[model samples]
Target: MRGDGSTPPRIPGPPVRGDGVEAIVAAGGLHNYQLELHAEYGPVVRFPLPGADLAVSVADPVLLEATAAINKRPEALFEFLTPLQESGNLQTLPAEEHIPWRRVMLSVLAGRPSHEAHFARFAELTSRTADRWADRAGDEPVELQKDLSELSLRMICEYALAGGLEPEEPGRVVAAFEDVLTEYLARLYQTDAPGTEDERRARAEEALTFLRATVDRVLAAYAERDDGPPERSDLVAALVAAGESPARIRDTVLMTLLAAHHTTGVAISWTLYLLARHPDAAERAAAEVDAVLGDRAAPDYGDLKRLTYLDMVLKEAMRLYPPGPYGAREATEDLTLGEYTVPAGTTIFYPFWAVHMNPEHWPDPEVFDPERFTPEASAGRHRLAYIPFGIGPRSCEGATLAMVEAELVLAMLLKRFRFRPAADRTITPIERFVLWAAEDIPMHLTPR
Candidate 1:
């Protein structure tokens, strides 16, 4: 086990075929690769990345505390985002810059005032999507991811832009954003060749231009409006009031959209999937919403706090299928994690899915059980045991916002419709910036 500060055992994976790149590929991407390594080699496993040095994977919550305060991220790992940032990629910003930027973000994103201000629009956007679903015939499958992604995009645009985007704006923004991401993700996987790479780059450029132009229009409209509060709650307004440049504000809005898009949608999708598969939990969640909302079509901001069971269900769902599966941190100083001492500059991979699956923390980890998050059951557990949104400084800035959105959407849908897993459908979870199903998560919705 090498408990004496020496390097942890290297995963004896598939004969190491040249820096273990081939082995990692064969293991089915980094998410599955880490799961296999942790299961076989224990909490901390050393493995080689294709073009990098040995990386350490940490699954044990206790060990995570040692690196919890790390402020640096592996630049190479986050290079995929460079194109989106002109000042700097948010993921790899230096601590001095990151702290202030994060402070500004948290001021708006994590504030109760900001959430309350946006809750009405969030509910409105959700209702619009649900209204479309209501029009579908019974037994028709709803494409959970696609529908919810658009819903999330709408919610974020409304929140970021202040008065909400035009009725036709979301579709164009969503399409352009997806076009940009499709090519960026392809490059991340090293799948683009010179010829195709150029094409992808061109497409990405066009899409980015469209997105920036859209943001410019929104900002221009904001400038021309007189209805904003003396103290701004909208992110763009807040950023501008703080004296940030137009380009910086635009980048911030785009980054927030990108972060919230698939993550919030997939989170809602997974929560629905889990609740559908576990009707008892779904019923309890619905009952809680009913009791709390009481004839109200959707929950008000204050009502969110009172929906306890819904909170537990969402937490448990995230434990099982975190929106973003994993994160990495670079050690700035030598640190000892349990019995092992890791050197500075080492890239420590926090495999959050594995951490959530640790039997020591979660009994029958794969089983969908909302009770796992009940206040009683959750007490005294490792703080890092459930890190779906990650931990420390680099955690999702909009986490509170994401949760508010998820709970509101879940309550509305479950209150009006019953979600049932479509028969004969298979869901394959893959890492696509976030953990997402390779195919749409199809579910039948019947009126409750």
Candidate 2:
């Protein structure tokens, strides 16, 4: 009962939105819609979604911080992951219930042995991918994002399935996921007639079911076979250690796959774009990789930590294009953020991706600047201001794993070749599924 508006028009049916509303919100996709909203409402816009629902878009960091601190699950949708989480049986499903569980998961990840295993596999994947890129060191333009998307998916599957699946299977899974996601995006922006939205939702749901079943079938066999803990680290080991049920474990693994597949690919794509645009930075990264890795040798676990500029470039790229582009949560009860108070059942959509690029948080936000992340220069900056992995306790669990993999792969490729944007490059983004360039990104690669 806090804000002012003229009885907001009712939009109907599962948020079956139109191009006009989309345009009002920047119809190109969520990212653009958000930017448009921010520009129009100054970070506090009340949007009426379909089905008589209301979502208040917010970007005020202080409000975000307060809500994130006092809020618990049920209020935060993240607590209810989809499908499996809908059943709500986890110990930490609620904020109070989640403390102990979060500690356990955190302990598992924080464990030295776990980190060692992760780094070991990271090294193996680095070498394998380097070998692939090296073979095509000539005129091929490596779609850094596409390649990593597949690699991250493959690596995650290996970590979960113990490396038994054929190489081509993951591609099929990714395609199915892409189809489902694209349909969902269309549903979000389209003003479909009554039953049409239901049909689209059904398709999206089926796509998810398909993926979930595939993971279950694999995990079922993985469960019976007694493979002692993998010597090299991976998420699969975490699954075994957690002693999760087959269905819950499958959901978690697929969730992990989706997380690993999208975020890492987005970052990798941006990194390549920045590197290609700024040849000086690319050359410096190449030099660093060459000097650190040496001729005919791949980077080791130790070398990953030493790639300073490469790390900065990755950070900068993420700053520009965050993987978790936006976030949404419903207010379970009345609450006040900044100057506004929202009522119970109000939805809030906050995009850290847009905040990262806010002119206030970033200087020349659009420009690629690796120096912004240098330890000394970055010492005084707002760490929260540049959260590609997001912030609070909800930050990505696989963050460290993803970053190490991205930097190592990017550095290895740069060590061997230079990639440039293709002729007449059309980097149109399709918000259908993941925010990816609509036309397949074409880049030309040349040997260093």
Candidate 3:
């Protein structure tokens, strides 16, 4: 922070407690704090938190493009995600190990298989849930976040894991994941040193071990079944067909769970919240759903595609409240960017929440306007500006699958029940592994 708007002659962070740095990071949330810092101290500043380590936020696109795309990732800071990524059977691989595993994931998540009964299962679960929700067609306050999380949990459990789901268990994994994930995000974004970094890794591994054991039992059963042609249309079958190793099966299953359940659930939850709060958007979405599915018909895959307006509605919702909020990378070597020199070990964070809401990038950043995404209007915006899934080689592997799931589930719910905000619902976003509402997104549902 200098007299002019230049990033001070040197970065102004690495402060763990005193000097007001830690307080800012702890108070404002991660990405939001980045914007607050940039607004006061200029586009780039160093934040020093003892447990998190030294880092810089670069609002400059050219510098970020050169650095983030330079083939490096934040290994230490993201180590917190390691246990979950590995044990849950998802993305624990380094760049090299990730190659084969990711390819295998692609084989299953590719669009062709999505059209089969897997997609049918998605629609089925959603429709069944809608039927239950529809029966409550009054001012009864339903927690949109809770509802979507349950609905998404069902879809992920049934489709990605074994078909028969116990209502109590997935939450064991989901709750652990969210809790640890929240702590990890706090450590990464707010701490100055890597004090408990290793300790946190140990806890993450413990949680991973629990999930891995669960996945292993499932895998053993999968192996013992030698009777007849496999009839399951879930992720296990998909992974078995993909030839995922027994050890990695848990990781992939959990990874897909994270992708399918955690992120998409938040997106759907927020979409419902936004639409419910903004009647115009909800009405527009309801209109589309009604036209496409009428009253009682469940939307087929093609029918889901025809609900283009809902897509805009979803996009705007994600733009306002991305399920996964920010992106991070580590500087492998000392790098020079516009007016600043970054240390080799510096972890670079891209405050995507800031990017999406920038006045320069998004006009009227706070308003809910689905029309902003019309094919013509969205023509030339920066491709990276709206990274709900992420970008580059590590972008969400199950993105296509998730989108189909989201569009279908949302279309079905809006068509079946209209949502309006319920008590104790607040729009304030919280960063807990993902961008989520601080409280349950409460809403009242009325049958349409």
Candidate 4:
């Protein structure tokens, strides 16, 4: 109510019409659509989103604080993920169940012991990729997304499964996961590719079956182990210790693999892409990596803390191009967002990309400046102003691990080579599961 005792002005937006798909398409993609939406309307805008009848998008970090406690995700928006999980859709799991599930996940993924335990293998894997790139340094430009995503998958496979699989198993596991994602994400975005709809669905189902069976195999192996349960740092072991059902365990592994790989892969790729475009920052980051490693190929676990500038560069790159561009939460009850009162069950969209670009919080938001992340500069900033990982209770459990992986990969790559954008390719970010380069980021590498 206003001072005059009238109702508050309805949140502004374009007139609601047929499912908002056409408008999203016209604006290029969801990320861009969000940028345009908030630029035209105020920070809080009510708009029709395809999956939800109507959604309130809050770009203001302060307003976002009001919605941070929401743990319920809109089922309709996450329904596409249902096929992959038998236990339930992990994305929209009810809070009572989700709380315990997240605890098990964090026990393994967010712990320092887990990161340290995995560091050697992570470095080895990253070094192997660096060696491959070094061999082809001048041959042809390397596809950053293609290769890095695969590397990230391998690293996560090793981390999540705890090396129970045979050498041949990782390759097959990566392939199966790729098949599942390619089909499902296509369905979500309605992309037209080579296969018929039935064919794609069939293939995805087959791949999903293989993935679940693979998890079962790992579980069986764990059961047969004579040396008691594996360590807490191991994801599979942690879940089993918590007495999660086989179906939930499988779902957890699948979701962890799904979440970890693409996001970390694209994050490193975008950081490299941005550095390639901004030579000065690239040079500075490289110099830092060189100084920190000091004739070593990669940094040890402890050395990661020293690469401050490179960390800033990675952060700013994510600010410019967040891996998961947006997330949604269903208001559990009536909520006040700034001046607007949102009713229960309303879909509240967290446009992470837009929030990062909000000029009120981030002045000259689009500029590729790493200094904005400096302690002095970041001092009084809103906490939610830079959520590369989504917000609050349902936020990614692997956030800590991801940073370690990305920084490790970036440190080694920057130490080994200087990357330059491929002359013939144009880099454009398109939303597919994760924010992906429409044409994979092609870069020519020069050995340092």
Q: Which candidate wins on lDDT? A: 4
* Candidate 2 accuracy as lDDT: 0.65
Best by TM-score: 4
What TM-score would you give candidate 4 relative to the actual structure?
A: 0.96
Better of 3 and 4 by lDDT: 4
> Which has the higher lDDT value, candidate number 2 or candidate number 4?
4
Candidate 1, residue 394: CA error in Å? 1.1
Which parts of model 1 are misplaced by more than 4 Å?
A: 1-21, 50-52, 192-195, 228-232
Ranking by lDDT: 4, 1, 3, 2
lDDT (0 to 1) per candidate: 0.84, 0.65, 0.69, 0.89
Model 2 Cα shift for residue 226 (angstroms): 2.7
The residue-by-residue lDDT of candidate 4 on 1-448, one tens digit each, is 6667977667888888776777888887888899999999989999888778899999999999999999999998988788889999999999999999899898888999999999999999999899999999999999998889878888998898766667666667666777777886566656565588898888888988887887788778767778765776788878878899988988888888878888999999999999999999999999998888998998999999999999999999999999999999999998888778899999999999999999999999889999999999899898999999998999999999999999999999999899999988778888777898998999999998
Separately for all candidates shown, the number of backbone clashes (residues 3 or more apart, or on different chains) is: 0, 3, 16, 0
For model 2, how does the per-residue alpha-carbon lDDT over 1-448 read when each residue is reduced to its tens digit?
3357534333221233432444534466667777766766675666654322456766655567645643332333332234434335341256664554455455544454555555556557666765787777665566766677877777666655665556777777777677565564444445332346677667667777778777777876776876665543445555556565555556566666777777777778878877888999988998888888887456766787889989999988777767677656556676676666677767666676667767766778788899989888688665556766656665666777677668866876787677888767777754433556666566777767
Q: Among all windows of ten consecutive residues in candidate 1, which has the lowest summed lDDT?
A: 9-18
Error of 4 at 367 (Å): 0.7
Model 3 TM-score (2 dp): 0.84
lDDT of 1 by residue, 224-310 (tens): 889746454678767877788777887898899888988999999999999899989888888888899889889999988899999
- Pairs with backbone N, CA or C atoms under 3 Å apart (clashes), candidate 4: none
